[model samples]
Target: MTSDAQVLAAIINALGAPKKIPSHPPKYRRAAVAIIIRIRPDHGRSSAHSSKRRHRQQPQPQAQPRQQTSLSKQPPHAEQPSCLDEIVHPESLDEFFAQTWVQSGVFEILFIERANKRAGDHRWTGHVALPGGKQASPDEDDQETAARETAEEIGLDLADPALFRCVGQLDDRELWTSFGRDFLMVLAPFVYLQLTPKSPPLKPQPDQVASVHWQPLSLFLDRLAHPQWTPMVINLSNKLAPRISRTILRPLFGTMALHSIEMPYKPEFILRYQQELVKDTDMHEKAHPCSFSHSHPPYPPAKTRTVAMIDHYPDWDPGHRPLRLWGLTLQMVADLLELKDGPIQPDIRHKVWDSHRMRKRLDAGHLPGFSQADMHFWVRALLKFHSWQQTEKNKPSESNRVGSWESYYRMVKQAFVFVVLGRATAIAVLVRMLRAPMFRMIQSSVPSVRHSKLLK
Candidate 1:
């Protein structure tokens, strides 16, 4: 054992060693932001292939874009604010991406932040952004402030900004200013998780989010509510059964005094909101007897029901896109066959892939004309080809989605896995073909797992 003096010297040296300064410094002021919609698994997760993410694949989540279908009827107070109260006016605020990382079908997107230093225009700034910073609470009426705060933070969903409803509100505390004027600031937070408009992902506010997602409530809520169920945090009650413990906490009551008080929504909010939409207080919404069809709306058809919904997003045209087909494709095909003997497809060809018709055939309990064993063989062959391509000298490796289904599906939900990984990867312009199938897969599961089937 070292002597006390020696130990003390070591400790001093450790402390004295030039502290590992942050690669970037805080060059800007702290602004008010509400981390709404924690995860957008729908668009998948992506990490820049260049440089990003601190904890390798940190949740690359974003608020989903609004639907364009019903924007003309947007409410007057729903529009986000435009005045440049804090930072300079935003030039562009779309969700953009660099390269994608697909690990076992999980895509990770990296965000952009002001690179700790204020004087540079480095695009590779930092991640977690707070683009929305403003007085969310107005005088007696709070719609303008709410709309503005959301606009500032999440401008991606706002070409027709008035569509965003001022549904929920959270009030922050007051902070004293240097001039002795008490700054009555209430962190105004709003959500667009279920916004209608979607496409080309609005725009990229390199300062807001690197990428935006169209996360479903079921998937999104699953993540926020089931955060590994930490022991220190509140234990979920058994009443909500599985989710009885974690439904969407809303109104959080905490001290109002602060530098910019951050608030939490009680879980009941998510559950209750879901109920209100279904129960429909009158002009609230239409009424339905709560059928599985409502819960999972996009079911192929009654005659075309299948044991599983295979997303064929990236597989637009198998013959033409086969060049980019990765090994995981083969593995999933094999699993379905193994589960249902003979082969999931006795009518469809192993090489030909089209999800729409495939969905129909699978539902009818009949393969279109594809050989199950042959499909497995093709899958194995594809996996080997991908392996060779990855190991080849100069070719860019497929450093994404694990090459096998064993990892892609994980344990939770296999069919649902690729939907996310595929979409996220698609955003980064990697494995382009997978995007459509992934989306189709998500649509398939929507009715089955969704808490609400209001999808357009």
Candidate 2:
């Protein structure tokens, strides 16, 4: 059994060596998200109290007066300390985790449920995601974008040296449409660790974040705690394709099957909107034109109204839905987990051709949220497509002309349809040719006079 400290060490080590992607053309957009990690006291642990007591017992150091240097004496272009420099060193991290109080704590990661869509933009609305947004002009770099977005969305400032430190970052990922046609943006994930024993109170911006949650990292690593993937069906009719294209392709592709992970633990909401937190049972009746009653809500009813009222709710639920990890956010989590646990096998390149073998490999490895059959196809397609992209990217002249994985997947889909239709047509022609000879033989078996009369 691995300790939480060991797991975190492995993650930090992985983040130290990130697979970075080069900046894309001006046409392509970029975004960044922060994966914030913190160790909180367990249900019965007194770590926070103990830490407070220890702080109170320690003697305070007297403040020293600052000596201002002359402007001429100071060196020009002196480099300032970065957030990365403030990160906990390996030796310090080990010492911190070695403490009894810190060892008893639970490792947790922060997540946020996005607010409802305004009008035209509906992407990631009400989705459980890491705190982040697109890159802005003021941001110094990609990592800065992550820190800025995190601070803007949730009031936990990653840049605050006293509270948090930049652990490192994960590999950059390119987002694509469901149909694999258009490229969306590149997503860069940065990891941060809380230096303090206790987490700071978070103030979620109501417009951006509907609620905030702290999910245990153990839930993602344990197979029994987090069950296998559940099917999330997508309607093809609601896609952005043209009506004529949809009509022609409806028979071949009317619906798409995706997978979602049902979070086992009930999320602890740090900050939530008032309307989402409460259930107004009498508000509907009071608002009705025919009703003229003014009733006061019961205390117990208000107390019992919580997010956990619905048991095992589906992902497609309209309002007050449970936290279901899926889509891009889930993929990011899996990527981090993969770093800690290592790959499923020494090499999965040969196994991509065999779906069953690959699925078995993923299952044996106990990879959370990736055991479904639907996911297997996608996993294989992406592996092959990425391999191809890498080959193309390496070529000198073709590197500039290389397309995204989406375009490659679309081409493969079109080819598959043509292959299926071509085979069907060939089989039909062969069957007709074979039946013609049998018909002639039956005609010969009939008497000459009867055959002639039938023909006439």
Candidate 3:
């Protein structure tokens, strides 16, 4: 049987070999992330790998004392070599099964969600992203950037090469931002195995981070794991009634983009809340806040207003609460898992491309342009049409409340606060500007008073 040390050594050796690294253009922005792996002891003895190892290591009964045969003389049995012979062979080492090793034992990686979520162009905000950021000048290279960002973001200091071993680099992929900042961003993913099994408590940077997630590596390797479709409705209703109505349907005035998302089920790595006694009912002390009780229905069920103000949303399956993973993060994970095709379904890719082309066409004036006045007219028309439809059906639409008196009152209160704040800011600026000049004038008058005193 191969010792655990031998298994780890084999992996380290395979990672040391040169890989076919992809080249990127200089104009593209470069970023890096560490695929941190924590190898745990394999507890499942029934696994094929474990069974094979057991079968190979089983002791064989000593050959029965050879009896002299009357007619035949059999050649003495060839000396048998240790199983470790194959593992130590240089050629066999080259063909070593990395997937078997990685998938054999229980392992997991770290993922983080960004805070201060921004909307529109920067749709990736608030999404689950690997602990990484854009490269800085202080970073000597992409690897350094990945290590430094990991330390800053998750408090994992990979700077010491002795602690973390680079498993190998994954193929580089380029992401050209279509919405927010128009630029080409390149991703360089570096896979790393934590040499030290016992890691320190993670201290995630709060301002830049919303939460930390530990994802099991097995989830990625699961072929059955598929991506979920998300509907993103871009509000193109000019600047007047922006964020009014959104739908997957091609808007006569707005745009609808379908974003491909893959949110795998929660792995065993993430710690769940422990059930505790609380007064009467059994309660979990650390329940997931975003999740709800089994009996209670999710509030504002998305289906209730699919075509209303909240058009941009994801389709969550029952018991499949997603972590909102999409965009570049999805691509990186797919690559790390050695997925031949990318994470997004091929058909979904076509739809997304079509949406992008549609957006481009609208921007190019291929469609009728909408003025701010036209947007306002559409807003009122939509409100009236929806109201009339509800009356005809004799049913109350939840979306109707978006533009109701209560909503208007809230809007008015927000506007009043904004006005008050704006006026106060302007007054403060004006006072600051006058104070400097008034101080100078007072200094000049003080000189005149000093002259008068000298004459006295």
Candidate 4:
């Protein structure tokens, strides 16, 4: 079996993020350290990579492997999977939340999640039991610091430094420092190896790890995604009702166009969460040219892209305005992020997209468009959108809460906070100014009575 450590070292080299090099003759950035415990299940004698076994308890004939048959080739012993055999999941780890999760210069994509948890009080909880880095004396390199810290934290041998991984680094940032300026520090990416029965000799040291043990990454993810998780998802369809209704949707009234779409659900869509938002056959049955049908998006053995959001909205055509926005957003975001060239520049916002020297990368295939560095920047902008404090205040709705009967008979909700915080002045004025609603309303009515929806 190939040493996981060696695999990790190769990965670090390919990532090329300077912070990961611990023996830094000239250190580039701050980083955190972690340990990737390889917990091999009892039946499967631990080996990180998959390779054929020459011998096993079950009777089998061993044939020399000239080359394993793949789609492009056929070998003498190529056989279909047995129908009676139980399906075993292939091992793998998923990229974290960042768009370039796998590609994050600061991150080291490591082990797969544990297949199943064992019953116990659960000190391991769900963590894979990674560790953090602490600087040793200035004399020590970051890699040295990592080895020292890991040994101190988990009682492992640093002399065999090759057991640890040196994944790249990410620039860490924190807000509201005691002195007022941002408090910035990086958590280096180095992982420790947890040997069996001993569990890496975790005898906690003071000023080292506050606590230690293994836990699945999923457990932490569960806590973060829980509704009670702090900074809960603030539902805005109500809070920003006035701004959404008055400003954004106002100008869009007449211009809002719809054509039932039928697009392919490629593997990328599956990775992005579109697989779960499966439309009913009826919807797919009637999909227009632009929309995806149910099946051409053959699920690939490996996945690449993912869907961002799938939610409903009221302001635009109730059929699915948000999907339309998401569709359009995906189209432009890839271009705007410069992952793809938008020279022909499809869609309305083409003029708004700024092209820089970075555009040259489009010609080069460091990626089809943006480099991994570009992806990090894109992620940063999204974070800004989440943390931005500006308001989107707006005009009041003329309709009085959908009438007493509907309010009494059905659930009614509105986003007062979002509306108050969005922008100044309700969006109704803009709608009135643009005369958009009236124009759209008139499309279904005689042109002479175009402004009639406003009367209602």
Candidate 5:
């Protein structure tokens, strides 16, 4: 079995070479997140290669001369205040690495809670997200964008290649608009292996980050964490289904959230709102189907409906604490855990992945809360539902439909058994033929019964 460090190194190297820096860069607004890995000393022997070999494969950081000074001068906020630690001054990269290495198998990952959004902004505000934002003009590539964002959000410098190791990148993902009508911003997640023994004591930018969390990688792997699930309602349900994309972020982020089928439009909901509007009397004419007034402008009164539309998401609280981790952040953690295994493990992978694969129709706006396994079974159920609906539309008798489904299921079971029996028989014959000479001779003699019978 490969060590954790070896597996991570393999993943990074396997990410392949990134594309060249485009002149115009296609004008697509992009974002990038850094998945920083802090390698703890394994009790077993380490298989790390020389620094020279590793450095040769890594892309050199393009440092801006004035960035260090400019970042230091920014005014600090009163809330969630942070202080930058003394910079580590080392004689050489070797010295820096030597001082930073520690003897622990546990690794740490970082996440940030975003500050509350300003009013009227529909984007993800006051959400827990990875430390990243829209790519800036100065960013030469996605790597640079990730590095720059990390430095700005948390005072860690990626430009100094000696201080950090760029372990390649995960796939890119898209953050869509509130209505899911179009792509809000495209995100590219880059993985980094922190050379320092301890995680960087970050000075978070208060305006952007509400708080910083250095969560143990081991804690995530713990089955006890019991990642939570919450229902999310959005306009475009199908667009959010996790698709396997090479250029996009789907592969990298590795989908985790479970989505439900689009529900049929609720005419009753409209009626309820109309009744409430008429009760207020202010917009009573507007509420009536036939009543229309120029002054009213055919809009319901603001004080109309009293009920909330949707339920809160991230409902499954692992620790039942105030802090909750879900959605994209949780998905990224799941993907990182499977780095050594190669490709996301379906059985253990998120429900979003399986749901997206089985998804046929995209109609509903709300993703009802369901477990990873529930989503898997739901997908299979959906396949059956579609078949049933088609048959039902033809107005088949209840008894006939039941009989047909039962027969179909029985046939499937018999086919499976037949295939298993054939494969087993073939394996048994092959095994005897490949055995020792004595066994082979015995087999030939035993087969003499069949041989003679065939000859006769």
Candidate 6:
């Protein structure tokens, strides 16, 4: 078993030599996200206090004043210190990880659940995501954009060297709409490691962030120890609704299988205004007459209530439903974990779409919500589609440019046409073959109907 230090060392090394993707043309917007990592004492463990004491005995670095960056031009209140900074200026990341506290502590990554807002980008609303947004003007580079967004969204000043340091960066990713119809932006992910013993208290902006959470890194690295990943059935009909009506797409592509990990950490709600709204609701209920019998109990107090409505929207109640990590965020984590032969759980790693693998998995009953025969048929059809994609890759066309919007759009269009035609043809053929058997079975079951005037 690899120690956390060894794993983190590998990550640092991988990030140091990242395969960087150049920014696209000015037409494409750029965005950045910060993957904030920290090591905190496992309070649940008995040796937590002892570990802290041992950490204190180690040579402490002199605290230098945080340098003012362009991001610091914002209001002073945003930059106020919220936690004691126990900074460590290690000669190397290996030395940093070798610290007594780090070795004993639990590694954690920060995540924020976006508030469900009616306006703005509805695609990411109520999603468990990293603190980030589109790059604004005054930003020198993508890293600055990530830092500024992090501070604005969650009050975590990544620019503050006293509390955190930018360890390295991951490869850039191209954002696309469903079925790759349109290019949204290029997302550059930067990795930051907390220097303090305890993380600074986060003040999430209620309008943007619903809540903040720190999930243990172990959950992603070890699957057997923590079995959180489960199959999540996505309604493909809903995903295709923008292009085609759900009524038409429902029967063709009902659902698609994906994996999601249940978040274990309890979210600290940032929207304190919800409590006031809950209070108003309580007052309204008290004034109104009861619809039920007098014996029915009154509603719980606003203070006692576990859930509250905010902006006429229900906040993500973890108690009601566990927050699941999936989609792009999960993919980013997978990419980070796979760096330098890190101990990332095999199941969570990305797998290319292959017919043979699909068949093998289907036969072993690994894939749920799909029949063996249906998978076999679809896999065969997809093989042809895959071949076409390879052939196109070899050609010297403008659309052959990988990760370009035009190329992605072409592939999506081809896939859409292929899937629709294949499904329609398969359904038609099945119906035709079953038609004769159905007539024979019906005649045998209802002899009188066969000889009746209706049959004639």
Every candidate's CA RMSD:
33.1, 14.2, 24.4, 25.6, 23.3, 13.6
- Candidate 2 residue runs with Cα over 4 Å from true position: 43-91, 224-227, 236-244, 264-321, 342-456
Q: By lDDT, is 2 or 6 better?
A: 6
- Best-to-worst ranking by TM-score: 6, 2, 5, 3, 4, 1
| Per-residue lDDT over 54-79 for candidate 4, one digit per residue giving the tens place of the 0 to 100 score | 13434765775656534457654443
Task: Give a tens-digit lDDT track for model 3, residues 246-270.
Answer: 3431244344233434445443222
How well is each residue in 1-456 modelled by candidate 5, as lDDT tens digits?
A: 223334444455455443222223334678788887665544322223223334677798787677665645766652222222112554543443333132224466666667544547636554556777778889888888888998998778877765677766655554543223355566677777676544555665655655565565545443223422344432222343333432363332222344321111111111111224334555565467555646554655456543322221223334433445555665555445544444422221111112222121121112333233433344345546545654566632222111222232233334334444666798899888778887767887898798899999
Clash list (residue pairs), candidate 6: none
My TM-score estimates for the predictions, one after another, are 0.22, 0.60, 0.44, 0.29, 0.44, 0.64
Error of 2 at 451 (Å): 22
Model 2 over residues 1-456: C-alpha lDDT tens digits?
126667787767665455566667644688999999887755344444445555788798677545554455666633221112122433466665655445666788888888755757777676889999999999888888998998888788888877877877776777766455466788899888888766776656666876677788777777423446665665443443456676775554445445566554344443332333465656655566445445533321443332312112224324454577776687677666655644232222222222222232212222222233343455445556655754565532121001222343354455445545666898899999999998998888788879799899
Clashes of 3: 1
After aligning candidate 3 to the native by TM-score, how far in Å is the CA of 193 from where it should be?
2.8
Candidate 1, 99-129: lDDT as tens digits: 1211102221111232223336553333223
lDDT of 6 by residue, 1-456 (tens): 126656777878766544455667744589999999998864334144444554688687677556744565778765342222233666666666655566667788899988866555686676889899999989999999999999998899899887888988876777766655566788888899998777787766767888788888877766423444377776656654565587776665656566667776466554544322344555646765672557544664455343333332325554566677776787677667656464222221212233332221111113334222453355445546765664565632221111322232344345556667777898999999999999999879787765695767
lDDT of 5: 0.48
Q: Per-residue lDDT for 308 in model 5?
A: 20
> What lDDT does the true structure give each of the candidates?
0.28, 0.60, 0.49, 0.30, 0.48, 0.64
Q: Residue 124 in model 3: shift from native, Å?
A: 5.6
Which ranges of candidate 1 are over 4 A from the true structure? 1-117, 120-131, 136-146, 149-154, 157-162, 173-185, 193-201, 207-220, 223-226, 229-456
* Per-residue error (Å), model 6, residue 46: 9.2
Output the TM-score of candidate 4: 0.29
Among these predictions, the greatest TM-score belongs to 6
* Model 6 ranges with Cα > 4 A deviation: 23-26, 43-87, 119-123, 224-229, 240-244, 270-320, 340-376, 379-416, 426-456
Model 3 misplacement above 4 A: 1-29, 46-55, 61-103, 117-125, 171-175, 179-181, 196-200, 223-321, 338-456
